[model samples]
Structures are given as structure tokens and as C-alpha cells.
Target chain A: MAPLRDPALEEISEALHAAPGAETITRLSAIDAVRARILLAIEHRLYAPGEQLPPLEALAEGLDVAPITARRALETLVEDGALVRRRGRGGGTFVAASPPQIQDSAVNVFRADEDAIRLLIDQRCLMESALVAAAAERITVEECDDLEALVDAAEQATTWAAFHSADRRFHRRCAELSGLVEATSYQTTYEMLARYFLPYPLDRLGGSHREHRAIVEALRAGDGSRAATTTREHVGSLRRDMFMALPR
Target chain B: MAPLRDPALEEISEALHAAPGAETITRLSAIDAVRARILLAIEHRLYAPGEQLPPLEALAEGLDVAPITARRALETLVEDGALVRRRGRGGGTFVAASPPQIQDSAVNVFRADEDAIRLLIDQRCLMESALVAAAAERITVEECDDLEALVDAAEQATTWAAFHSADRRFHRRCAELSGLVEATSYQTTYEMLARYFLPYPLDRLGGSHREHRAIVEALRAGDGSRAATTTREHVGSLRRDMFMALPR
Candidate 1:
């Protein structure tokens, strides 16, 4: 929920490391994979602050890892302030209400693969197009108005994290409006792609806000075909208009 | 995997129980939910036959179930002949290489939810369309030949299980041809919907083999749009054609 580091500082860091469409990191080690998965779950709010993680044995099983490996992942996360361990009765490891914004590099795992990035983009386009078409058919006037309000909120958001939170809600609303059960898969795909996203400046995010409004207009008119086109244009522009699509 | 029950008899059973589009069962109990998850994992081949399963503590953790509850689910699965146990060295509960085919009703859990079925279908449509389109862009003639062979294999399959096996491979090939790293997500989405699939007659399956050939033709011609359209029409027809659409 906080910036990974100072915005200007991080941008400069990213620019320095820019490799231009090359593999950004080596393949993830298994321990790093586990650590990243748990971190993602926290960011995804699967484990809310104050929520207890499953016991280490269970966590290991869930992750299909050895108990010692799971223990090591927990130790690193706790040390970085992402998780906490409490002992004695009625106590266990818990997500830190304020997980330290340490310079943990585990979350960088997703950007390592060129093929995954391409696949996710293609997958997102397909799912987003389908969802937007469906939403145009079913979204109510009230829902459209609520969507506009979300757009306004994002435009006014003060921080990268706040913008991100609203951005997720806005896209999730598009999927939900489709009134389809499998819309949940859209979120899963979206999150996987989002992991590859580096932070964007607020003003650049504001540029994207216009496309969001255009999508709402198409939905309000109940034009599925137009909405789908508008949606594709929006997603396609993601690589160019904002976010990381460069050699970084 | 063994047939869920007597093949001929189950077909007749399916006919009698068919409601044409109604929810046939109540909501899944949590234990049944866990049971279904494990069964699906087996069917997906994540845990191979004769492979040892995680210990109770780990399995429970992985499933987010209490140890007692996880035990009950495993017990029911074992009783149904889907799993087995052996004592002593390297011994734990294992998937029965020749697990007995029992009329265990837990596999029916997925069909209980109308929304989930529809969602899975929608989600599949999006992902499959994307994968097929990407496949057309990248498939080599040799890969196309391999796909044609899989289609042929499905045509020759004598049992529903055999057809199902080839069917999985054929679709998986579509994703793999794209050479996209996240193509694995396609398999995940496919298996989730497959959990809701009812067995179709082999002849009925044979009738659907035509579409597979059409898809291959489009891919071989390097026609991405055509391949994608053919894929959509093929998936769309699933509701009315080969698979379940009636309220049973």
C-alpha cells in the first residue's frame, strides 16, 4: 500500500537498470518464488493485516515446498517487516499491519520473462475485450455513474498506491459489470500482468483516466462492439501510453 | 484415471438425471470442496498415480482446512477408491495407480453452481481465443502436423477417458504453439471448467472432431483472425453441442 521507494529515486534507479526488453532478472529461486507468492497474496489482500497465515506445515503444503524452505521464506519476510511472528497461546505469524517498506527485491520476479510479458498482454486483451462487451450489455445506469465517480477518484488520488487501489477497483468494476461468473479469472490474469508493472507517475496515470471515461461512455450506450473496441485500444495503449513497455 | 463409474450405466444415469439446466445439487459442503480440489488436482495430474501426498498437516494447510477436516476428506476419497495408504518406509497416503472406480458423488460439486459454469465458459472463451490467435502467428508446419495427429488420436480413442486424454493434449498444444510463458494459465483455466464436464459418447465426440481440423487449417495457413474466430465458434457451440447446457 506504500510506494516501493521514493518515486523520483526509484524512477532514476529503474532508468539506470534499463536493459530494453531483455530479461531483467535471473530465473527465480524456489525460495524467492515462495516469498514472492506470499507477498503477492498480501498485496492482493488474500491475507489482510492481522490475519494469521496457515501453520508453517500447511503453508509448505499449500506451496508444495519443504517445511524448512517455508520457514526460510517466513524468516526473510519477517526480517524485512512484511510479516510478524508472535509466540505463546493464541499467537502465530501474522501479516504486519504496517509491513515495513523495506527494499525487498523479491517482488521483481515477474518482470524477468519476455514470453510471460507478451502472453499476459495478449491474455489481458482477450479477457478485457470480452468483459467490456459483456458489461456494455448488462451494466445499469447507476453502475455507470458509480464508475464515473471511481474515475474521478483516481484522477484526484494523491499517491501511487492510492491510484493503484482505485485503478484495480475501476477495472474490477468493468469485469463485475459483465455479470459473468468467470469474471473472477479476469482478475487473476490482471493481477499476474500487474505484477510486471512498474510504478507510473500520477500525471501519466491521469492521461489513462481519459480512456477509462471513454469506456464508460460506450458502456452507458449499451454498445458492446464499440465498448470492446474502446477497451482494446485502451489496453493496447498500456504498452505505450503509460506503465512499463520499454526495454526496462 | 479410471472411469468415475460403469461407463454405459453412467450414460443412462446421466440421461435420467438430466434436468436440462437446473442446479441438480445443493451447495458444496466445505469437506466436499476440499475433496473436489484434491480430486481435480489428481485429474490434472499434479499428483501422479502412486505419488505420495503431502502429510495431513501440510495438506490441511494447503487446503486451508483444519487437520481433522482434511483427514475426513482424504478418508472419503480413499473409501471411494481414488487414493490408498501403505505403511512403513516411504509410505504415506498415495494416489492409487489403479484406484477403484466408485460412484463417489463429490465430483458433482462443480455443476452445482450455475454462475461458476457460465463464468468458466466465458473465461475459457477469452483465453482460448487469445491462445489460438497467438498460435496461428507462431506455429510451425511440424507443430501443425503434431496437432493434426492429436486430432486423429482423439478420433481413434475407444473410451471416454481416452478421448478426454487426447482432448486435453490437443488443446494444450494450442497454447504451447504460441511459445508464450504464461500459456500455463490456459491449462489452469481449462482444468477448472473440465471439472464440470460430463462424459459424452465417443461418437458424439467424434462428431466434434471436425472443428479441431478446421482450427489446424487456419493455424497452418498463418491466419490468426480466422483461427481465433473458428476457436470462438467452436467454444460457443459447446453450450449447445457436445457438453452440458440443459438444466439437469
Candidate 2:
């Protein structure tokens, strides 16, 4: 019911209003949107564990919403156990010391049948290919070196945990290099969905590393299309591996 | 924080508690999530314009949330001008008569640069290809005939508006035929974003129709891969057209 307060928010609202047959989103919707963004930030580790978020007023101004709206958003996070609000002169809102863990059953979040799983895999293939293509065009030499290092780390990983960590960083770095912040943000969602299919067999590590190496090499060569193609194949291979690993 | 009341709600809560590094989504969060799903249903025309929604109690039972949570969710929509809440024995929440229009600026929802747009297009390419592949494998003769009718309608369309509607139905039908409900649901989000790039020139219609015919042929022949490839090309062409139409 609140009037448009921020110009950016107003622009977004106006766009939604103009969309034919689209339902209107109100200022209250902004509260949810802001909350989701902050939660995503925390989930992605953009806000490190135990890190304090900006004061409510500052967050409100930054998001161009009323202080009450920002406060409500933060309160939702607090209620959700994603954040801890401290009182006293030095106290503020902080990322929870312990955030909720995504259970193995988190795949249930997809509420998807096997067909939907395949569809999700298909989506990932396309999205990752695009990320690699964009990264190939814009990735700096330094970023390329970072990717190489991640691949090398994965190759040497004696434990599946270490290998998986490096593998996630490798893919996430590619998204970051693509210079699409939203895409990078979305990579977290993809990874969360992927957690269910993980703990890939140690035997598959060698093959996976090889695929990662090919992706990095293609990026190093600045061949966008090649990078994209290789990335697609790489994701396809993972999908195959997942299907094989699932219990019959 | 209200305690979980229903056994089902408690089970979900316990699952969240078991998850590591995930935020706990509380009942209030459910309100927002339910609100979003309902809004999406309305936007996708699952809930037709002017149709009264099921009572809050029914909705709550369906979503397995508290009645209050469902009420709050509907109230949020009411505040947002997406729904009308009326009192009296026969009155209920109805979709607003004039739903908010998404302004041309609604593309701002992506908060994306050009790269994000390209990534989105790539995503569509992959998704559509998968849908077509599934459709190719499973499309009944009746469904194929329906698709043919849609193509014919598009071919005969005199205005871009008419053609666009047929085009949308064609794509949606492909997803529906895939028998992946979640994937079909996701198609709405893709379509919402695609709206920003709509209204193909009259000259482009013939070529577009030809592409559609090729897709339908591939489906009729039960050539899944070919259908997939053709669908990908079709989406790619649309992406190209969109890019060309954008102001330099």
C-alpha cells in the first residue's frame, strides 16, 4: 500500500504494471524481494559467517525502501535463523553463527520427478555453456590462472570433499568471470540443487578434472564457442554420472 | 516464532533443521512463498482473470500451512492490487479486474547487462530443445495435430499480436506435451522474460513459421535429437531478432 519511494523501485514497479496481464507487485513485495536477496547473499557466503550486516537505516537507504521495510526484511531473516540480531551499543544484525544446513534431502526442494531432474540438467547445460562463453570473451588472464589453479587443486584432491570444494569454486569462478552478477548469483541456486547429486565417486574425479582442464584451456584460448561447447559436454557428462550413481 | 502446529509442517521443519548451511524458512516465509505461487498461477492464467480463488481455509489445507498463513498471503496480494477481497456470504478473493501492467521497463527485473540477456536466451534454447525432445518422443497423434493447428493459425495470422499469441501457445503446448509439469510451470517464467523481446516484424513471420513447421515435422517423425536441434535454432533466431531490435 506504500507509494513508490525509490526511483529504481518505482521503475521496476512501473514495468510490472505495464506488463499486460501481469499481476501487480506492491511495496510489500519489495520486503520479500529484499529478504530473499539478503538470504541469498548469506547462503552464497557473500556475507561471511558471523559478519554483521549494515545497520537497518543504511540498508534501507541502499535498497531505497523505508527503514521499516528493511527492518521487517531483516526480522524475517532473524526469524529464519539466517541472521542473529544483537542488542546493546555495539550490537547489530549478524550472519548466524550457525546457518541451517541443506540436507541431502534438499533435492526434495526441487519437488521434481525424474523427468524434471532431466529438465533441470538440461537447463544447467545451457546456462553453464553461456557462462563459459561470456567468460571466454571477458575473463582476465588472472582469472584464467585462478581457474587453472582450481583445476590443479581438484586434481590433487585426495578426499572427495576437497575435490568437490575445488570443483564448485571452479564453476563459480567461471560465472564470476562472465561479468553477469545475476548469473553468478544464480550459480548458487544451481549448486544447491547439485548438492543432492554430489559426493561423486573418487574414480570419476580423474575424468571430471580432465573436463575442467579442457574448459579452462578453451577459456585461455579465448575461444568463446569452444569454451561453451566444452562446458556443455562437461555438464552432460556430470548428468550421465549422476544417473549412473542413482540407485536403480 | 510460532511453533509448528501440523504434523506435516513439523516434518518439513525438522528437515530444515537437519539441513546444514541453509536458512530455516518459517511459517511467515511460507506465507510469502504461497503468495508467490498463487501470483504465478494467476500470471500464467491457471487462475483465470476474475475467477474467485478457493477460500483461505482450503488453500491452507492444500499447502499444508496454517489458515492464518494463507490468509496473510492472500491479504498481501490484496494489498498489491493483484486480488480483490470482498465480504458477504458469496464473496471471496478475486483476481483484480485490471491486473497491473508490466511496464516496458520490466526488463529491469533482470538487473542484467547485455550478457545476462544472452545467458537467458541460451537458457531458453536449452530448455526449449529439451521440451521438444521429450515431445518428439511422447507426443500423441492428437497432440501433433494440435500443434499443426497452432502452426497453421500462426501462418494465417495477419497481425503480430495474433501471431505472438499463437506462438506462445505453440511453445507452451510443447512443454505441456513433455508431461513434465514442473518444466511446464517454469515455462511461464521464461515467457515472462521473453515478453520484453516480443512483437516480431511482419516480415519475420514467414521465416518463423517455417521454423515451427520444421519442429513439428521433427516431432512427427519422432526424431528427438532433430527436434531438439531445430528448436534450439528457432530460439536462437528469436534471440538474434531481439538483439537487432534493441536500440543501439
Candidate 3:
């Protein structure tokens, strides 16, 4: 697969080239630039997820900068969710998931699970309601097929983990149907973290799948409020279940 | 001010110490472990915001590991939004922010502008309603003071920027009071981004301050629905104002 490049890479590279800093060119300023480069590097698959990063010496050499400069640059990427570091024997650098496609990028950079997964689900519930409402108002014919297939996958899955994965795909599909792909990163972060905090059992999947069908039906009939309400319950139930299962 | 430390630093240090081999950990595995370290570091201010990081060699030496191992550990911290780096001259690593403190952390992570900010505010409206409802059912006296003070700050502000700053504090305080500090990051992210992208003229301060008073009164009265509704309008107006300033 072609590696993805960060949307911000070209802008920074261009800025770096355009900057008239003959003396200070070797120094780094604005940690965002370093982060942008790392993100771009990851997107390009120059550094694959779970793959160790080049030694700080190598990276500094490649970027034509100092080891501390390279080290700090990598550290910024770590802060931005583009890189991960390990310590101890055999520990090395690796890529994390691509930074979420953000529609609103002005907010402070979120470290994954900083808000934890539960809070992300709560936000997802809010966004899902709006997404369903939007999909009800304007879901394409092809999109309906996609949604059906996701639901079908969920129903066919026998294991809890598989069903949970399908459930995530189904909701993600719904969000995409609403034409909000750029906003998925915020929600995706939550779901990914939620995996660590609350793993769902397979038996809890049936009811939500049935509810998904109802939401689809509501969308088919152009009943936006109904579709939105149903979608809210569907996603909210996931949060509710996790909350109930919270270690007492 | 002393920089905030991430909360997971010590745990990660321990984990790294306990790991058995040189095999690189799995993607999420290393990501989560390093993430814990970054957070703990932030909590402890080991990596202060805007401060340069030690050279990669130094980190490796301190951790008693290979330079390659140190690279991986730092890489993960970058991805987790706990650090920022620069390259060339005058650049190194710096801590990003401590969690549970909203604006600084959330704003840097997400970008919220006019169109995107509107959607986020709308999302906030939904969450605020639910949060306030939950708070009404369960909130403390000390939390109430924090909420009230935020409103007072908003009312006393003289500039639109100052008012907006106080306004954010008010809403975030409400979220904190709701005892869902975890869920409030999204809202905090929105508020912080809005402050940056939707700066108002200095003249518009009073109107927002008035809205602040009304929302606070509602919360003070234990009127969850009223607090929810009023807060929605308050945020919705900011969104509307921002959209009005947009081209086309």
C-alpha cells in the first residue's frame, strides 16, 4: 500500500526552503516543523508503524542537523501522536496510527487516551447523532449497501473481538456516509483507546445490529430525527455497557 | 510557571526496566507503554513545556540503554502529544502539556475554525446538556465555587479576548464540576481553538459576559436543562459570529 503523507508536509518544507536564515538554518525553531516532517515521513511509509526509527545520529545526519536537534524533533512527533519510543533492551522507535484527519486543527494537540476512551465515546455519541441526521438527509444509494454489508459482517461474526471490530467498522461507515471523514480521527482515537479500557463481549452485539437496521430504515424513509435518535442509542449503548463493566 | 508533567512517567520507566529482550514491541504495545511514560513525565515536569530536551545521547545514557533504544522511547513520546521538537540551531525537545488542564493541551492538538468550530460547538451543546444533567444529579459545593468564579471572571473581563478567555474557563469549569474531566477535553479543545480562530472585536465583550451570568445562574439554581439550553445558545452564538466573519 502507498504510504500516506501528512497534509502539512509540503507547507513546512516550502517554508523551510523559503526562509532566509543562512546562519540559523542548521538550528530548529517551531517544534511543529519537526513534527510535520516526522508525520510526513510516516505517511510516506518511510517509517512504518511498529518499525523502529533510525538512530538519532542517522536522523540528524539525514536532516542535516544535530543529534539533540534530531532527538527533540522526534520527541515532538511523539507528542503529536505520530511516533512512539521504547526504553530498555531491544527498545526502539515505531510509528503509531496516522494522526487523525482533523477538520479542526487549532485545538491543542491531543495525546492518545489523554481523555481516555470513555470520554471519546461520549463525544462519538454526540457526533453520531448529528451524523445520522445528516445521513438521513442525504445518504447515497451506494452508501446504503455499504452500511448493510457492515451490519451483515457484524451478524456473521461469532467472536466477541470480531464482532466488536465489525461494530466499529459499521459506525465508522455511518460517519463516512455523513461525509465527515475528516472528523473521524477524533472519534477513531477514542475507539482505539476504548479497546484498551473496555473490550466488549460478543453477546452484546446482536441488539445493536438490529438497531442499526432500524436506523438504516429511518434513513431510507428520510426520517432524520428518528435516524439520529436510533444512531445515538446504538452508539450510546456501547458507552453504557463499558461503563457498567467498569471495575467496581 | 512550572511546567506540568505527564502522569504515566514512572510506570513507563518501570515497564521499560522490566522488559526482557531487544525485540521491538508491537505497535500499540510500545505506544501505550511510552505514552504512560510521557504522561508521567508531564505530571512530574521532567520535560517542561517550551524547554529544550537533553540530547538523545544523554537520554540513552540516563536510561542505561543503547542510543537506538533511547530513540524508540522518545519517538513514542512524540506521538503521544507529550513533547515537541525542533531541528537545526536553537531547537531541541520540550514537553507539550499536562493533561486535565484543558485549553493549552486541547488547543494545540486540534484546530477549530469558523466552519469546523460550529460543528464542534454543536457537539458541545449535546454533551453539555448531558453533562449538566449528570452534574445536577451529582455535584459538590467546592466544584460549585469553581464554576461560579469562572462566570465572575467572564463578567469582569474588559476585552473580547479576555471575555472569551474567561468564557472558556467558565465552560471548562462546568465540565470539571460535572466530574467528567475526562469527557471535557473535546469541549476544551473546541473552546481553545475557538479562542484562536474566532477572535472577536474588543467591543463585543459585554454580550458574552451577560450570557455567562445567565448560564451560571442556571447552574447555580440546579437547573440542568436551563443550564444546558443557555450554554448551547452561548456557544451557538459564538459559532454564528464566527461564521458571519467567514468569506462567502
Candidate 4:
């Protein structure tokens, strides 16, 4: 994929500036800005896996950023296992394929489930619980409607893949509604893992749909505890469904 | 940190190639070879945080690999979050400043009770238990000696910081002994967090020392279960000590 700029990041940065006085604005350092730009580029597949990046000077010119700033951005990517580099006569930078292996010994099981699918569901639950707790105090009317629509879409999904995709989107939108960007970003790894192990089961879709509905109903009724409770149950069901789909 | 290749990686790759027979020689793919080279360089702090990497073409020439191949290596670095890229006048790649946040939750209260510290200790127990179980069937004599020395160093430490440092080394060495590099990497993160948050109570250091002796003795006896148990109890004492030191 071609490398492209992410206007959304700039838009978000602008919104942050406008929402607060200039004194309160937290401008990203050049390195962070460059790093975020590259991540966005990867997410959008503007720079697809296995593609070579332009020369450092060319990249700096294209991004309208300083060479050092771009350099840090690339370094951050490498640390995250998103890119690799080498030096010599015929070498240049290129995009990396796949993701890095995150070691998960029992000591640091992050969220404490063994199976990848189970961890994915638990992770979503933890984030949703945090978000719904906050959203109950501040969810906007428009957001409430949007959440309900997502639940409806999931409920109407005919196949497992469609239902699963909708399910993630529904939960993700909930996190968005809560207005916590970092929490949303934290789930990116889980999302990537989920994609890697796609074509999960549909037999348990009905159970998930019901749970999703309960969560929506609770949100509509402005009950934080109920929303959390429903979300927990829903996540539990997803965990079971995921395990069932896997061959022992 | 100078920007250079990782000597250890180079040595290992060379050793693998020098193993003589094709059967003994394991050739890494070009991408992996370059990636390993970069990691070795970075891990040894060849590229310090914020240090600019060599130009892509320059790197390619030095490595005697095609420019595209070199670019792929750089891309792998980017993917790993080690480096960032820029496009403009005087732009280049550079190392990342801070490590990525490992999606750790505040599950181990580490504060609520002696239970809090003990719970985290229990996690270490579980991890080490798994490691020992694996290691009993896999450890080499040299690794056992490393573990023994690490334990001795911890026992000899006087200050809280020194003891904690040695304690981390001991536990990490134990994992390394298990021949599970990936799991041991996770153990490194666990050790970092534990060391960061768990303060040592100097007065109780003697008890911890005895526990370490017990663990080593168990390992010497080739009793995996006993070694695992001893390690858990040893970590448990540290937890209890932390509890007593907590602000009343």
C-alpha cells in the first residue's frame, strides 16, 4: 500500500486545541506526531506490508516534517515490531508483515485468560465496563441512538462472521462514546489477534445478540450497573463461544 | 549508545551457519536475518533512544543485501516501534523513547492487603512453577549454576534496591533456565513491574534469604515440585514484608 497522511489525526489535534485554551492544549512532540502518522498509515494500509518506504530525505519532504522527527517515528515503529531497518549499499526502509509476539507467561497474564479468544473477550469486557461506567454519567443522546443501531445491526446479522464483526464494532463504539482514546487504542492488539483467527462460530450468535440487547436496553434506561452486568455476561458468552469454535 | 549492529545476534547467526553440516545449520530467512541483526544492535543500545539510524541505501550497501531487502529490515524495525520515519529535508529514522505500555490492569491491588502482595507473589509462583516444571526436563548444568549465583547475589544484598535487583535477576535467570525464551521475555516484564512496585523490607531480608536457599536446595535435589513450592513461598515472604511496610 502507498504511504499516505492521516488527516483525522490532525483533525483530532485541532479539536484538542480548540476545546481548551492554548495554555491547556497538549501538543504532541514532533516524534509522537510522526509516530501517530505512521501508525495511521499502517492502519489504513497506505503503506502495506512488504512495501519499501521512500528515502529518508524524500519521506521528510513528503510528510512536511523534519528528518529527526521522522526518524524517531520510524524508530518507535520498529520498537513496536511494526518495521525493520538495515544499513548498506542496496538497503532502504520497508514495511513489515505480521505483528510481534507478545510474551504471556503466567506471571504477567495481563487480563488472566489462557486462550487468545478468551483474552480478547475479557479485554473487551474490561474496557466496556470502564467505559459504560463513565458513559452512564455522560452519554449523549445521539450516542445512545448510535449504540442502539449497532446492536440492531448485530441482531439482524445472518452469518457468524457478520455478527462477530458487528459485535466488535458495537463494543468499540461504546468505548468511543465514553471518550477514552487510550482505552480504545489499548484494544488494538486484541482486534489484530481477532482478525488473525477469523471465521469463528455462529452457533452461539443468538446468545451474544441477546446479551448485546440487554446492554443496549440498560444504556437506554440509564443504568450503569445493569449495562456493566450485561456486558460482563456478554463477554463471558463470547469467551465460551470462542473456545467452542476451537478444536481441542 | 552508538548506532551499530548487535554483536550477540551476529555471533549466534554466525554460529548457526558455522555448525558445519547442513543438518546442523539453520539458515534464517533474509528478512529474519536482518531483523535479528537490528534487534541485537538496538538491545545492546547501539541505537540509543532518539538516535538517528543510517540512511536506508547506506545500510543496504553495508549489509551486502539488496536495497529492497535492507528497506524490509528497516520496515521490520518500524513495525516493532523501535524506529520512526519522516519525509522532508534532513529527515531519517530514529529510536523510540519509551517502551510500549504492556496492557497491564490493576488486578493485583498490591496495596489492599498482605493478600495484595501475596497475590502478585502467587502469580510469580504460578509462572515459576510452570517454568520449573518445564526446566526440570530441560535445564543445562551451566544454567543451573547461573540460577545458583543469582540466588546467592540476592541473599547477599544489603539494601532494598540491591536485593530487589538481585531478586529480579534470580527469577529471570530461573526462567531463562527453562529454555523458554518467549516466556522468559514475559517474565522480564513481570520482574520489572514487581521490582518497581514492591519495596523490600530490610529487616525481613534474612527470611527471604533462607527461602532462596530452600529453593536452590530443592532444585539441586532435582525435585521440580519442591523447587516450585519453595520459590512460591519465597516470593510469598516478600509479599508479606511489603504488607508490613505499607503505610498504616
Which one is best on lDDT?
Answer: 1
- Residue B17, model 1: lDDT of 26
- lDDT per residue for candidate 2 within B2-85, as digits (tens), equals 221432222322222121222321222556546655665555454667877766665565445689987987787888788998
What lDDT tens digits, residue by residue, belong to model 4 across residues A1-248? 11112232222222221212222324355565455545544444556676666667556544556888778778877887877786797677777876443331211221121233333344444445545644565687787888888888877865544565677688777766655433333244235334222233244456767777777777777766567557656655555444233332
Model 3, A1-248: lDDT tens per residue?
A: 12223232222122222212222222225344345445544444445566666666655543444678768767766766667888899887777755543221211122222323344566766556656665666787777877888888878875544566676677767766765433354353334333232223345456888998998788778766667568667766755454333332
Model 3 off-target regions past 4 Å?
Answer: A1-115, A140-142, A197-201, A243-248, B1-158, B165-186, B191-200, B203-248
Chain A of candidate 2 gets a TM-score of 0.53
Worst 10 residues of 4 chain A by lDDT: A104-113
Determine which window of 10 residues in candidate 4 chain B has minimal summed lDDT: B103-112
Judge the docking of candidate 3 as incorrect, acceptable, medium or high: incorrect
Task: Quote the lDDT for A178 in model 3.
Answer: 65
TM-score of model 2 vs. true structure? 0.40
Candidate 2 lDDT, tens digit per residue, A78-126? 8878889889988999989887743312122222223334444556665
Ranking the candidates on TM-score from highest down gives 1, 2, 3, 4
**Chain B alone, TM-score of each model?**
0.57, 0.53, 0.48, 0.47
lDDT by residue (tens digit), candidate 1, B1-248: 22223222222223222322333313456687678767765664556688778778766654556889879998988888899988899888999997654444555534334344554566677777666766786789999999999999989976655677788889888988866543665665566556455444455665468889999999999876567667767776665542235422
lDDT of 1 by residue, A1-248 (tens): 22223322222223222322333313456687678767765665556677778778767655556989989989989987899999999889999997654444655543334334454565677688667776786789999999999988878876555667778889998988877544676775576556455434355565579888999999999876567667777777764532224432
Q: For model 2, state the Cα shift of residue B110 in Å.
A: 9.6
Residue A53 CA displacement from its true place in model 2, Å: 27
Q: Give the best candidate by DockQ.
A: 1
